[model samples]
Target: MESLQEKNRGYGSIFRNLNFFSIWIGQTISVVGDFLYIIALMWWVLEKTGSTAAMATVAICSSLPAIILGPFAGTYVDRVDKRRLLILMDLGRGVLIAVPGVLYFLNQLQVWHIFVIAAFLSSMSTFFNPALASFLPVIVNKEQLVRANSISQMSSNLSGIIGPALGGALVALFGAGTVMILDALSFFVSVIAIFLVRVKVEQVFPSEERKRFLQELMDGLNFIRKESGILGLVVLFSVLNFFVAPVGVLIPLMVKKILKMGAEGFGVLGSSISVGMVLGSLFLGMIGGVRRKGTFIMIGIVVAGSFLALFGVSESFWTSIFLLGGCGFGFSFANILVPVVFQSKIPHEKQGRVFGTLGTISGGLRPISLALVGVMGGLLHIQMIVFLSGVLVALGGLTGFLIPGIKKL
Candidate 1:
């Protein structure tokens, strides 16, 4: 692993590393499967229950694990073999997600079953995600991280473009149960793809007399505090998430209420953002390494926020599409760079915990932001709330320039 980093290979060499390529392929397949699974599951729930509340309940169940198990999950990831853990997560999710399809076939499927499976799956991801973050540095050289992330980002965006349309069509033709079964099969394929990867990970901590879980968790938190700009970055992202959360909730309203464009218009607006992200990632990949990463992060945020503010004021549907696309393009810069910063700045041994802590903070913020959006939705016009949120987000990005902690990073 150390030898790979020392090589300092060119950007295109990222794909030549079979280890990284294997995992990337696995992750790409898994991401698309996830979209298929979610669309099928949510659609089935809505179709059967005829209640939006049930759909929301399922969503809440899926998110609870990350908020609850985040720190602990990270600690565990640091203590174990990440490769084995990734396989286990894929295996577990593949099986658990299949339960719904099996039950449906047996005429025993229930809303509660979906809830339980979703929670358990989320718990697995809480560990899997951090482990993957920690594992990446081990497989690829440092020089490849940016391009690797860009390619990964591109795959996700591509999946976003393809998955929902394919999932919806499959669900319409074959039923949700069949779509879910196929998703399960996709995970198994991921397991195989992951199994082919090979790498030797060094032991970071001594085996004997390890600290208690809570102590290690605090150590992770303290690391964040002591590190330059990291804590600020975390705070920035948490607040940014709060401001951005409303965009998803309000887009449909803007299309339906303001533009009177309905579901077809909403789909078009959504796809535009995904297309923009794909292009943004491609551009980043072409540029290779960015010298002033902090400046890039702030620029990305401001661009995204500016477009979002424009989106709020867009009375025309086509205008809203353009604005949302710009929002996605701007978002990609910050999204890809933030992880690169973390992966580069943090120690490999502590990366798991740091990533875990990030998951907790971000996941914990989701519900609060949603609730605030709901409250603001009732009091003020949607346009006002979105415009204000965008302005605040843009200003929040500007703070990175003012605060020495973030600016110097």
Candidate 2:
């Protein structure tokens, strides 16, 4: 008995209320641009310096700033309007990216320029992530959190699949500077998409009129310390991150040294992982949401770690590709579970601080892991190093069993 207009209105309301789509679209654009910039920057550094350490430095600098600024950024995100915060973060990054692009065109490009820009962009992203993570639950219904996170993961994976291939061609044809220009433009597009979304912010601790900065920070830390389930998840993820960090540095080495492939091969290797991630994400999205998310996450991590270890040992290109792809799929599956749990359990008001603290711990450890991986890979064989990383991840998974909630999830 319902009219078509009424039916359509129902659909319209459903779509509009789901702010995940908006965030997903914006992130997709930004991620693709980021991929392009990453390829371009790495190539630019290699061309200029011809040093693997120099190239590795790019990764370290990019991550360190976020680790340093994460706590303060998280605290600020909780206090501010998340929508505007995202917009401003995008704009800030866009302008920073433009600095190098403009200078490169004017023939003033240098390795230091890339380092500075990478650090600046990384710092901006520290603010952006905690805000975005905390904001998602506010805009989307709790029932849709898993689906929303899955869709977001799909967008990121798709970007990973497409962006590197596009970046390779662009780097070959137009140069890194041009690719950077494209990245800067993508940020503008993201800013526009974020601007269109409307969100209702909930204040968690209404009784605390105002608190000192250090007091507020300590409060966030205390919240995490008090929440056993959340604390356990954070510890579990941090250990996982420590082991997984090697993959980024070691993948390039494997393609270049072990596989004896060039830049195109590197692109192919990266794209292969992305392909698997996309498929995994699609599977998760179609399923709506997993009921036993923690269990699923643990299983995924175990599978991913196994694949990564196999990937390190494989000699044939196809074997390596398949293993890496499998790893990507498992990684995506595990990734979707974490954010859903965080959004579901953590109070909306405290999300910023909690996620920030988690970010600080996880993000801080990554670069140290990368540095260790780089140094170890340099000192030992790449395969052995990678295999060790995989072993660590698998061992870390056992920690989940110790945390009862994680095993139950």
Candidate 3:
């Protein structure tokens, strides 16, 4: 009871801190704009190209830049001023996305323009993501970390919920071009929000010191290599990505083909997961955070995977929704805890690079998994594949408990 009351107090404190609140509010607005912009962009592409392949190409293009640039992006993040980097990234992406809107109005838009702009924005995300992740630990104190992160996660989830619904309305009224222009305008709001943040940033590298790019990159790799817990984290995610990532491909097919639930079912299933994420993050915030992070993470992963496995075998739509909700809840619990663990362990100086490297390894697995799932799902039963993958994820998650380095951390 005492602990619970303390956690309640912590939640109140998070909102009271004006600096963090300013950033969070601005970020929430921009994120909502991002959601609407993406829906519009995708709608525009499908209309223009009339090609599923084009859609896949755009998705692949978005992932590729982060995979390729993640490590180096982190190095630069560690070296420079994060506030400026963030502002620049948002500005560049804003300008890039806005151009298509103008070109479309002028009736001079080309197919290649969308493709190129998509790639450019994606590349900027590699820098922006890590910088944002690293920045929070600096601005927010350790005690406030859990509530702050929960607030951040909640805002993001809210955007996802609001984005599509709001985007659809805007598109119906003013079309994709207007949505894109509004999206660009959101970036300016983000820039102004960031400008309002008045916190001191202690530089990671000295002004006089300049190391070779490759050497700086290698230092980050070595840091991960030397830390067994970090390596365990990387390897664990790689395994999840390989086996579990394919579930993304399998879920829609399973819904349409096996369950015969169609698009509404798909939307319902998505909403279930989103609800779980929002609720789970809120729950974590209410409880503050767990100290035995690895153990909590291990439990979270195993439970989430088990629920996913159950979701695969479910016949009824409601049952599948229940199981998926459980899975989402468990994963969200663990996800929040993992970042708290990482922020505590990593130095403020190397946070950007470390986070970048982690992001790369985490996201890099999807393409390979998607490829294999695409092929294998065509040949074999997708539900069975999903079932087996869930089991593998559970098994893989257990390995963390077995590894002393990670478990004890």
Candidate 4:
């Protein structure tokens, strides 16, 4: 009992730092804004086009730029000050979102306009993500990585739970444009929070013989290929994302068409998933860390895939909500473990590029999946398409078991 007590205390001490708390706060605020924007964006697109394909296209636009520019963004992240990179990314997104709002007020809003903005915002996000992944270690000790990630995940889930519901109400009362304004304001708040945190940014490669941008980009790709564990994880995530894409694209359709619900139903459904994610993150946080993370991740993926399949099969609104919520929980469980494993294993110098390359490839697969689902859902029944996606997701996890290294994560 005494030894167990000491172990728990030791683990708790790892996350007991001022810097980690500050960065965590900034990330939380940013996540809240992201969640709100997700609901607002989906609603706006759905209202305008009245098509699932259009909404999925919006999602594709938001993610494709990030995928295309991921390698370059990763290289750049390694070269620049991460804090400044984060601040600039937030500001860029804030300004871009404001453009759509201003257009709405001027009665110049168009579906294409939203798609373009989504692309630009996603492009900015491409840079932000790798930097944040690399920056977390600089601010927190390695021992606390899991805990920090768990806290971050929990906050993100909490935001997801609350943001969509609030965004729905705001959009219902005020307008989608007004919700955009709130999202923009949230970015400013995030920027200010990040600005207050002070940390020494470590240089990955000192100034000695600068290489061409293209050369540097290739270097990042090569790095991933050479690193077996990193490459394996990237491949796994890409597969997972491809299958999971349909879930995001179809949720709106499920609420609007299948469930015979409105935007408010969408909000409630989204919130239910968030609630489950929060629970999952909290469970991970309490555990602090685990041995054999790879096994845990595989189990999570299998569970998530099963839930997705179940969600598609069920017609009862309550049953769908529970299934989607379970999917969210399993998804977060796998997600939190993946990053922790990568951060723990990958060297600081190589993190940005590896994460970037991984982000690009994995992110790119999602949009293609979305487009496929959106188009297919139009022709086939939504439930059938969703069920197929769930099968793919399950297959992806089963494939992971075949890969010895990933099975061990």
Candidate 5:
């Protein structure tokens, strides 16, 4: 057991756990590469095809795999050696991502090629994410979960700050092919770093106890159904995602049409959110464990929703930046701690399936929400849409308190 002193040792303490640190370093590097891939791929497709529909295909291909494969992928994750699965996923994605770059240099890359690769890579992610989540609790002490997750969130946020600007410069100087290759190399870095970490997993399910695969998947859903808090949390996130996902699409329209700001203003607004997330993550990590987890999560939801609402109404560019930043800060609490709660509440063996189901539900909402936002934007004012979404999000968060199961969590 971890002593009180060790448990209370703060964020720096997680770095001393070599396994967590190794995976952290690898993932941070990989996330930067991911951002590079996004920028390079999107820019290349749009530039080459000059078609918005072509660009939209990239989104559809990337997202469809998760909705299709999520449950089965989670079932596989629970049955496999996570470290080995993770390595394969990283290696496969690395190789797949390099294909476009290779083909580009050979003058053989096509729009269809990008579409296939994006789908394969997204399929790999369907496996990698739940495996990573399931693997974390096995490798570290329970006391370290929050700080560990916080540090993980912080690195991704930090990468968001650096990756695009860096990718844009590289794409300009060297071209998308070179950027894709760099992104592939980043995945290799992750593979090597993860390889160095040692994890000893105790098999909780005996061969005799193992059921058919479909039954196992059904069991996971059953667990969620029985656990009212988990069910409530999942629904809350699904609803919140439906309301918030369109903000990404809306922000550009807001800046261009409503705020009368340039591309620079759009960039600044995006960065403001990332910067706030970094600070929020850093703050949570440093604080270690938090009590009254339920209350904090609710407050986080309200704070984020309130700021987003304020941003919707604000005419001043600077004020919008500030509100978006606060919105990001408020989001961090729920983002980091909810997983911590899940890690504690769910049985280790079942985590992969449960997280996968939750992820699919949330991820599935994104495309639907974005599509609706397009239709709604045609009929309503963008500011009104933003304001209404924010209000609904806050109202959704407030419902958590009303649920006896979630309120007491």
Candidate 6:
């Protein structure tokens, strides 16, 4: 058992646990590479094809694997040696990512090549995510979950700050092929960090605990159906995501058409949101998060929507940046709290499936919503669409609170 002081240590205490820190640093580096590579890929594709279809293919290929494979990935995660799986996945992905960089260097890279790599990486991600999520609680003390997650979010957010700016600079100075090598190397770093962290026997499922894979998957869905709070939370996020997806497609248009901002100005707005995410993540990590988890989450939904709406209405370039920053801050709350609440509620054995299912439901709407919004933009004022979308999200996020038990958590 941990002492009061130990439990209260928050983010600072996470470093003292070398196991968590190693994975944290490794994963953060990996995230930086991911963003950097994405910018390089997008820019290269645009330069080559000059087609929106090629760009949209990137989004579709990236998401298709997750929507299709997440549940099975979660099921297997519950059955496997999670540490081994993480290491293997990292190794596999490192090799795969490097293939493209190598091909590009040889001047053999084609636009179709990007789509192939995206599909493979997306498939592997389904396994990597559930394995990592389920594995966290095994290594860190329960008291440290929130801080640990917050730190994780902080690192990823930090990469969002660094990745694009740095990627653009490096790609310009060096080239896409060279910058991609950096992404490949980050995985090696991740694998090394995972290797260093000792996986306790208790962390692995007992052989006797194994069940038929089909049953295991069903059990995961059953868990969600049985828990009203979890069900409500899932529904809240799904509805929120459905409404929020349109904003992603609309934001760039808003900046260009409504605010009369140039590409550089739009980029600045992105950086502001990333900055806010980093700050919000750090604040949560340092404070160890709020005790009234449910209430905080509810407030986050409203705040996110409120700020998003403000961004829609604001005429000043700087004002939009501030509101978007707030939107990012609110997202940090949702990102950190949703997982913590799930970890607290679900049994460890079932976490992979639950989180996987939750992730799919939450994320599945994105591609659909993006398409719907693009079509809707043709008929409605994009600004009106954005404002109404924000309104819906704010309303949907609050719906979880109306459930009887969620507020008490």
Q: Identify the superior model by TM-score, candidate 3 or candidate 4.
A: 4
What would the per-residue lDDT of candidate 6 be over residues 1-409, giving only the tens digit for each residue?
9887765585667788889889998999998898778767766675676444466566667777887888888888887788999999999999989988999999999988998999999999889998898888888878778888888888888887788667766766777898788999999999999999986634344257667788888877888989887787777777788788766556656666778864445446666777778888877776675787777788888888888887877778888889888988888888898789988888898888877787787778767765665456667887787788778878876776787666876
lDDT of 5 by residue, 1-409 (tens): 9877765477667787899999999999999888777767866775687444465566667877987788888888888889999999999999999999999999999999998998999999999999999999987888778878888888887886677657766777788899899999999999999999888676566257788889888867888889988788887888898888766656656776778864446546766776788888988876777877788788889888988988888878889989988998888889888999889998898888888887876677766776666566667787888888888788878887887777777
**Candidate that beats the other on lDDT, 1 or 5, i.e. the better one:** 5
- Candidate 4 local Cα displacement, residue 255, angstroms: 0.3
Q: Write the per-residue lDDT of candidate 4 for residues 367-393, one digit (tens) a residue.
A: 878888778877988888788777778
The TM-score between candidate 1 and the true structure equals: 0.86
Q: In the order shown, what is each candidate's alpha-carbon RMSD?
A: 3.6, 3.1, 4.1, 2.5, 3.2, 3.1
> Could you tell me the lDDT of residue 40 within candidate 4?
83
Q: For model 6, where is the 10-residue window of minimal lDDT?
A: 199-208
TM-score of each: 0.86, 0.92, 0.83, 0.94, 0.87, 0.87
lDDT for model 3 comes to: 0.77
lDDT of each: 0.80, 0.79, 0.77, 0.82, 0.81, 0.79
Model 3: per-residue lDDT, tens digit, 1-409? 4674465466676777777888898899898888777767766665576443455455666777888899999988988889888999988988987998898788887767887887899999899988988999888888778778888887776775666557756766777888888889988899899888888688865346877777778767777888888788777887786777767545655666677764445545755665666777878877776777788778778888898898888878888888887887778766687788778888888888888888788778766665666556557776788888889888878888998877877
Q: Write out the backbone clash pairs for model 6.
A: none
What TM-score does candidate 4 get on C-alpha atoms? 0.94
Candidate 3 clashes: the total is 0
lDDT of 2 by residue, 1-409 (tens): 9864454332233355546567777889999999888777776776687555666678888888877788888888888888998999999999998888888899998898888888988988999999999988877767667766777787788899888878877887887889899999999999998987876675566465867667767767888787777777788888888888777766766776789876666667777888888888877777765887777777778878888888878777878888989988888877788899888887887788778888887666888787776566567888987888887787777667678867665
Q: What is the lDDT of residue 39 in candidate 2?
A: 72
